[model samples]
Target: MVDEASKDGLNALAQAAKQAPRDSPRDSTRRGLPPVHLWNPDHCGEIDIVIRRDGVWMHEGSPIARKELVRLFSTVLRKDPDGYHLVTPVEKLRIRVDDLPFRAVSLGREGDDLIFVTDVGDEVRAGPDDPIMVQTDPITGEPAPRIHVRRDLWARIARPVFYELVEMAEEVDGQLVVRSGGQAFPLGAVA
Candidate 1:
């Protein structure tokens, strides 16, 4: 498998992506963010987090510095408040708690819609005209939360990222049925 990130030629589009395209009609709702490609030059030195719904995707205007993105996301996950929501182009991610090294993709904007790519390079993309729903970890059963974390002896990290995700997953049923929130979804389905 390719390295998680190997954007060898993605930097070339950074300058062009700096501003929203002049040709398209801007959506009043999007607040004037431009659509960038799968890879953009400006993001080369940045530590960005891609929402991992389908696979890998980037937000239209969320161009933060590399480390800042990690810090912000880390802090949010640590807070782990009830009813917390992380809205991306494709879905809204929310949960009571989350561990780190969480695998995900961003909601990359194409025209008016959003897309996602996974760590292993699978994509989940849908048209902007259509609505998509991704939900937070919901409480399923009354069982005590079970936390399972795998330690890597050789691969050291500041803290294990997957541990947080595992913690969040422990609170729910394996089925994880989420109520549908959009036209593309149906009732009581697993997201």
Candidate 2:
């Protein structure tokens, strides 16, 4: 069953977590990432882990409460056409992501730059490199907003945080746009 698989996967995750170096992700702006993009290690296997839409990391059919471990694993996370996977020097394990892998928990403004703090404590500033995008569900027609963190990874802006963004939006060309780093990112139409 999936439960058994999750248990085995958790053990692997725990072991892998220990191997991952404890580095300050807060300094990502100054230093580059771990070069997961460049590392094309062979796929080890699938891991029975799933990141829920609410930003919960589930292992062994239970939520992973260790924030530090989650942060460490996040460093190796990569996205490809197949799906999301956690990569290391020796192996790579595929993991299920119901939505985005991260959630934007808070937001701040410094001058013209907008900074977002993810649940795992990743701070990203919106600019040309990282941009905010809003996608409307085709079936439900509800807006789902996400902000790019690094490479191809994105953090879904939490609903309450999205409300704060809506409050800060300005009407430009009949579109709701928020300015950050002197760049304007359109949320959607002013409906």
Candidate 3:
């Protein structure tokens, strides 16, 4: 459980994230992504922020309603070996993720490529760089599908979108595979 002081710290971090500039001159010069991967900030400790399975950000048992704040926080999100952390230039704070951090809410197609739009508005094209993977839940035997977004970050494909993928799937080597960017991503075995 998170203490009151930690909750206050999380609030401060959220505030800081909100105030951070999104499209500054320096950012414009960079073609894609802030170098969160290269940043080795000090661990400020874990905060009482959780990203729920349904894509809700919660702090101190309350939902964080500000979409811009959520978007800003998403920008700094990094998933390391230990778990997920919200990283800044100076500090990194651990946050709880019930499942995956982002959810792929919609899908589109550009010729042979499959484009996925995440809840945070990140557009991911599934290919060699970003591949679709589905893991079967051991207990429930359900498929948990995900797509790589950027640099080890992934978005859990929502069920409806997964259904869309199913519609596009074709049999390949007795496996249900979806073709995108001239690559075949196996959704699962034909059952």
Candidate 4:
């Protein structure tokens, strides 16, 4: 028959997931390890960034016309870096805010570092050598603390989810496009 606790656990996980973007994960896998946002997915395909307001929107979720949020734009580059230069234009960006939604803090390259400036400055980074982290509940136009992770762990856990989400980010041709890292072994093409 049905297990009540098991059912409840699944429901709780779903409830938490429903509140956030797919693959926009909050992992507590290793204690004392500052959380890394997990995005690994099983399949690899075209992916698009979703701009949802209010709740977790779908693949075809519409952007709320808020200039305070970052709408889909041409990517300067997607990173798979052990090391990256902070001065690259890939870092500089801004997003418009609306009523309520799963927001992203897009930091732009500033001088010798990337500045994660947002209304809720929960997630931010100053440079390449910084940590890739997420902070809960922040204010507008504020800079978040730096997020960091070990490089190998990042590749192992982070990469696959990115492939899946990137696949879902599939409107580049007037939609998103799924792309693999350039140096990926066997070079996973958008499949």
Evaluated at residue 37, the lDDT of candidate 4 is 28
lDDT of 3: 0.85
| Shift of residue 114 alpha carbon in model 3, Å | 0.3
Model 1: residues with Cα > 4 Å off, grouped in runs: 1-8, 19-26, 35-185, 189-191
lDDT of 3 by residue, 39-152 (tens): 788898887789999999988788888887787788889999999999877779999999899999999999999999999878888898889999987878899999998767
Global fold similarity of model 4 (TM-score):
0.20
TM values, all candidates: 0.22, 0.87, 0.87, 0.20
Per-residue error (Å), model 2, residue 189? 1.1
- Model 1 has an lDDT value of 0.28
Rank the models by TM-score, top first: 2, 3, 1, 4
RMSD of each: 16.5, 2.8, 3.3, 19.0
Q: Highest TM-score, which number?
A: 2
How many clashing residue pairs appear in each of the predictions shown? 24, 0, 0, 41
Q: Give the per-residue lDDT digits (tens) of candidate 1, residues 24-96.
A: 4454332233332211222123223343332123333242245434333322221112332332222224432
C-alpha local distance difference test of each model: 0.28, 0.85, 0.85, 0.29
Error of 2 at 152 (Å): 0.7
Candidate 3 positional error at 154, Å: 1.2
**Candidate 1 TM-score over all chains jointly:** 0.22
For candidate 4, the C-alpha RMSD (Å) to the true structure equals: 19.0
Model 2 pairs whose backbones collide = none
